[model samples]
Target: MSHRESDRRQFLKKSAATAAAVSVPYFLTGQNAAAADEQKANESNDRPIVGCIGTGSRWHAVGPNAMQLGDVAAVCDVDANHAAGAKKKVTEIQSKKGSDRQVDVYEDYQKILDRKDIEIVTIVTTDHWHSKIAIEAMKAGKDVYCEKPLTLTIDEGKKICQVAKETGRVFQVGTQQRSEMGLRFLQAVALVRNGRIGEVQNIAVAIGGAPACNSIPVVDVPSGLNWEKWLGQAPLVDYRWAKNGNTVNTRCHYEFRWWYEYSGGKLTDWGAHHVDIAQWAIGQSEDGMGPRSIEPIYAKHPVDFKDGMPVQDDRYNTATQFHIKATFGDGVVMDIKDSHQDELGFDNGIMFMGTEGRFLVNRGKIVGAPVDALKENPLPENAIAEIYGGSMPARGNAHMANFFEAVKTRKLPISDVFTHHRALTTCHLSNIAIRLNRSLKWDPQTEQILGDDQANAMQSRDARKGYEVTV
Candidate 1:
């Protein structure tokens, strides 16, 4: 073995053996005796030594899938208490399997990366911190399983794609919709391409947008939590909960999704899933290609980012309503979302209304007019199109298992970053249009929004210092 590999082996041997003698929790001492042995054994047997970086409520739910996929060697979080909660679940798994794998815990994720034995790192941190740790973990030579909307800025997405390619590391973005089922639902899409849909006219999506945030009072950082690390790449503003002023206490945990500084809100949250389906439904995975033009007209209610800062308002800043018409080079019109009605509509899916017939697809179902058509004599086969699967992946429980499986095989998972970037590009444009409040034409080949300097600016975010996204 090379010197580096030899040192890694020695470190595992000593840490595991020595840690066993110390009866303290692994996070406190940075290693547990039994876990060190598990790490060494996993190495000899070729099983991946897995470590998770976030242990919030979401991780509590997603942990079992990863354990089923590989050996759970360690867990980390900014909060010690949260870490303990997650560590308990992992310990239970270890106990159930009767596998003596010790799960070391750490308040800081850097300690996990410092270990050369960890092969795959699952990052479920806040939206703002996703790219920061993901890029760093990949740099540390670990495969990354990052949650979606894997970037806080367009620049971050670009950097993540670049880093994955540069480091030769396998990276999977957790979009999850594309891998839910046995069938990909592409045959129907092939029919659409074969003109069975007959000259696609206008396509409409009805997903919602993120609300804007206003000024709120700063609160004390919780005890035993690494607030600075939590805010690693975000602005160094005082701590403010993502909830409204009166509800700030209710929003203390996991509600970080609604803040613009931390995330793009629904624009990225659900958009990552639905826009991905929309792109696949329309075959827009190829990054260099996108809508030729876009026009984001304000709905009756729109979030205004005046002076490039959020106004301190109690009402949410996310766009409750807005419309943007996307035009493709082939004269295909795709309406990403329609805000025509509020009571009930296709609010979270992609609908393609073609001349042949109107087809609609959502998470729960994919049904359309002439609904029985695919079942009928079906459209004649086309040499150009591959067979289309009938539906999106079932994300009820199997999402993370698929990710770990891909890691071991060194293959790109269904929700790989390359495909996600295109989908996110579309979703980001809607925000661009809404923020700029005007018509914008885009050059897909050029990857530029035409004519409006202000609209084009929203393509990237102002990353905080020490966390600027660079390729």
Candidate 2:
């Protein structure tokens, strides 16, 4: 049978087995935000104390949702001014919304994490810091809502999941698209499972991974900035652009995406979102299992390799136009890459070609592939419930909203890490292929690349000292 058919069968089987394991939610997690705010302030259900690790634009993206969920108790940023600015914004929003909640400001994120009163923490820090801080927070008993791509390396991926399992903490990797309403993810995932599209064929995803951000010259580190701490793990480099009074040459905090040391580039940045949706559609995001084979099909080299893997390419290392193809055991081909050809989802979207028809889905929209498929939306039953193993969310809303709801009612959010892991595996695996530039076979159940020692080495990243993420 085709991969689609096999997956559908597996889904049905799993559904039968897990029907009693997960309880369906009544009205979604935490009481409505309006209700949450109106909670009588009876010492028992006062506002939830909230803290943040990073306060950039992305953190602002969830400002309203976070407010809906809890009070924005504190904001932290390495740059003193950045933290102050965020605190001001939070205070304004709270006051305007009549939240009657106080917001605090802190220069060090560790201080926020140290709090005993903090119920949930959001880590919007650089990618390098995600696993370490998140794991530490979970250890500290504060549930996390870390920004994505959740982990900087595959090993960290395993570590975070392992830690989460050990701690029983409710963690949500920030991929807001997972929470979008109209043209949501589940419809497409369900269609794939229901065989609305027939025997699956090769799938295509177009997303531009990190292009070179630019080779900025090194300069003096700005005042009030802990350049050493910012570099954290990953080799320490001189600070060039500290974003003080005027812009520095090029080096800076957010732009860290350009360098491999800090992030996986857009390969993991946008990949966090696009790759996530792709995984959900392909039914791969679960546990630590990965694709059957990964071929680093495309790169600029002189890139060193250790253990048969490429050494970190410091010069804008992340793939610019990397194209990777992963073939599943049952002949399902998944293509992931950056694109501009059409109005695809987040630089890329998931395109599935099956025996019956084809379907494409991304954060922005979910479109039918065949000309008539869009017209013939007459599937008999709830196709979503069929293929998703009845595990994904039944309702779609802001991603954080889902998480907050899940936290209260104890239901799984639409983008739980298990499934997202599968998606990230695809994204991270594509990196493995581009870096190694070789066809590598994999044993999904075992989660290892076979035969090729070189490709296997890229499975995990070598984190810098003091930043090693341990399970």
Candidate 3:
């Protein structure tokens, strides 16, 4: 171990000793503690030790939320600036709570994983890094709270699920829609599942498309940023300056979504939210259940493609315009489009059209003839609560709280990894179809692209050496 690692270990050991007398729960030592003893300690402890990874723009909010449930022991990021900022924020939150706690900052996440005391890890990393880090964390005996769009590809989802099952780790996917205030999404899903929408025929999901841009100019790697480490499992490529050219930052941080090399663009970004809710409402959120076929009716890309692979490496090549249709085995067609300006006449929300009535729901509001009818005769008080696995409605930070609760009780959270993966599979299939500009059959049961070898091969990508995510 390096001097820094040694110092951190000593600090953690000292902190653990101080916690026993200070009435604050510190790290849970994995050494020589029986399962029953660990459970008792977990139940009685005032707080858990949490490590926040990928402290970037999104983590500004996620980090604070995590501090609410546990003491943040460390913050890790590829960017030194992000790690420092997150460490400062963690300290501020701890201090405000009348605790004099110090947070360790590290550029390498492995250090955080190597610590035996970190019982929980929050992964808010970029799209490509989610699965690899999450899997390793679970193997390290740490429960995980991973953000939405859980995996970069369908294969990663399968691997994550397998590891989660084998390890019996509490894994929560950050699809807050499942536990939003007023339980609007839960209520909407209840209405559909309860047959409020009779014989659901179609659903429409409106989300933004990926932006198309010319080749970004290659530039020098900035100070305090590890470009190679940030790339992680992605193929090696030269760092480039931002399009604006004023800042030295590259197409990293929050801007990585526009690149197919790292992400599937809005197809996974926003679709992870909207598509997930769609699957829940339609009763296809579980494993072995998903769309039977995906058709990319129309698509526009920033660069040329051969066999679904972008030819140019410099440009933001993800599709900018797309109208993809996914048909479930039940003959329910889900139309995922860039906007609602098409014939459906909808905007950025989910619309469920059924024989009895139709309803539209988003973060803003839930409306339609079915929902309006509920005004006269509201749903039972327990209706929404029942749909959320017998738990009450979750308001601000309730999703995170749910993960903590599951960590203690060893129960599955509201948004488990299995269902999130099934939903994300639909999103990935849509992107694959759009990239190929063709319709393809899917077998959700086997999690395979049926009879299309090319499409099936796209389910997983070869990871770079040292970053491979093996089961």
Candidate 4:
């Protein structure tokens, strides 16, 4: 082992020893553990050592949330600045808790995965890197907490599900709307599932459009960044960036979301969150249930496209304006659109219209006829809990804590991979429909596109040599 690995192992050993004496290291030391029995108490008394992969702007939030539940022993990112910033944050968190633990920094995520001391890893990498890193982490015997839109393609989701089942790792996709948001989402789901919204005739999800960016200028790779490594699994391309006042637009970092090469634009960005809830509330998140057909009614991309592939590489290629219709096997029509409906009067939210009543829900509020009627007739006490697999509604950062608790019980978290893959499959199909500018027949049971070979081929991408995702 290298000197850094040697020190990490030694520090972990010492930290484990300290935890044994200072306090019982139950998987949950927070309010969630108040009702545990002695056997449960001893199940995972040693706090799990965690390693954070991809400490970018998103990691600033995810890393701190996870620190509330586990020890962050190490952080890794391709950019030296990100890794250094994450290490500093981890040290500050540990220090505030009265522990003077030193946080190790790494340029390669494989180093974090190779360390046996790390029991959990939070993957906040870009959309394309999520699958490869998560599969490797599970194979290395570590549970994973990965960010949203977990898979870049349909087949990648299948691969992740296969690995998750085979390894029996407790994985949590960071779709916090299921576990947080003041329990409004949970309540909305409960309302729909309990017939509060009647038969659910139609659902409309408005997840705003992607921004059109001017052609970003090709620039020299900045120091402390591994441009080649950062593009793992993605095609080798020139590093591009340009400055506009206080904002820097680039084909790297946060701007990667706007490029189809790295992400699916709003289809997967906000769609990952809103569409997941729409399907969840409609009770179509099961493995063999999903939209039967997706039609791209209207779509406008920033670049020209032929054969569903962007023609130019100098600009953002994802669809900027879209209105897609997803028809489920149950005759439920879900409209995923970019603009707000004047009737609904909200720019971003889910509106379920049903036989008897209707309601609207977003991060801000859950309102409408059915929600308003709750004043006179409230939902059952255990209604939302039942929808959430018996866990009471928890607010703020509970997603990470739920993952740690699952580490002890081996149960799936509120946002498990199975449901997430189903939701993401809908988003992926919608993107494909827009790219092809046509309608698609889907077989949710077989997870295939019916009679469309080219569309079926888009289900998976050939990774660049040396970066293919391995079992």
lDDT of 1 by residue, 201-303 (tens): 7777777754444555566777877777677666665665445445552123465776566776676787787666666555555556567777775542334
Worst 10 residues of 1 by lDDT: 22-31
Rank by TM-score (best first): 4, 3, 2, 1
What's the lDDT for all of these models? 0.65, 0.66, 0.82, 0.85
RMSD of 2: 4.1
Which is the winner by TM-score between candidate 1 and candidate 4? Answer: 4
Runs with alpha carbons beyond 4 Å of true place in candidate 1: 1-45, 181-196, 209-217, 241-252, 299-304, 313-316, 338-345, 378-398
Candidate 2: regions farther than 4 A off: 1-8, 15-24, 28-45, 242-249, 300-315, 340-347, 369-376, 379-397
Q: How far is 86's C-alpha from truth in model 3 (Å)?
A: 0.7
lDDT of 3: 0.82
Clashing pairs in 3: 340-346
> Candidate 1's C-alpha lDDT?
0.65
Task: Kindly list the per-residue Cα lDDT of model 3 for residues 1-471, writing each as its tens digit.
Answer: 764345334433543342232221222223332233334544776688999999988888777877767788999999998888888888887897676767898989999999987999999999999999999999999999999889999999999999999999999898888876457788888888667888788988998877665567888887999999999999999987665554333468777888888899889998999999998777676656789999998988888999999998887877788889998876789999888754535668899999898888888888888898887977887666656656563345667766776788777777889889999999999989988888999988899999899999999999999999888
TM-score, cand. 3:
0.89
Give the root-mean-square deviation of each candidate in angstroms.
12.8, 4.1, 12.1, 10.9
- If scored against the real structure, what TM-score would every candidate get? 0.79, 0.85, 0.89, 0.91
Give the per-residue Cα lDDT of candidate 1 at 50. Answer: 85
Which 10 residues in a row give candidate 3 its minimum summed lDDT? 19-28
Model 3 residue runs over 4 Å out of place are 1-45, 243-250, 342-345
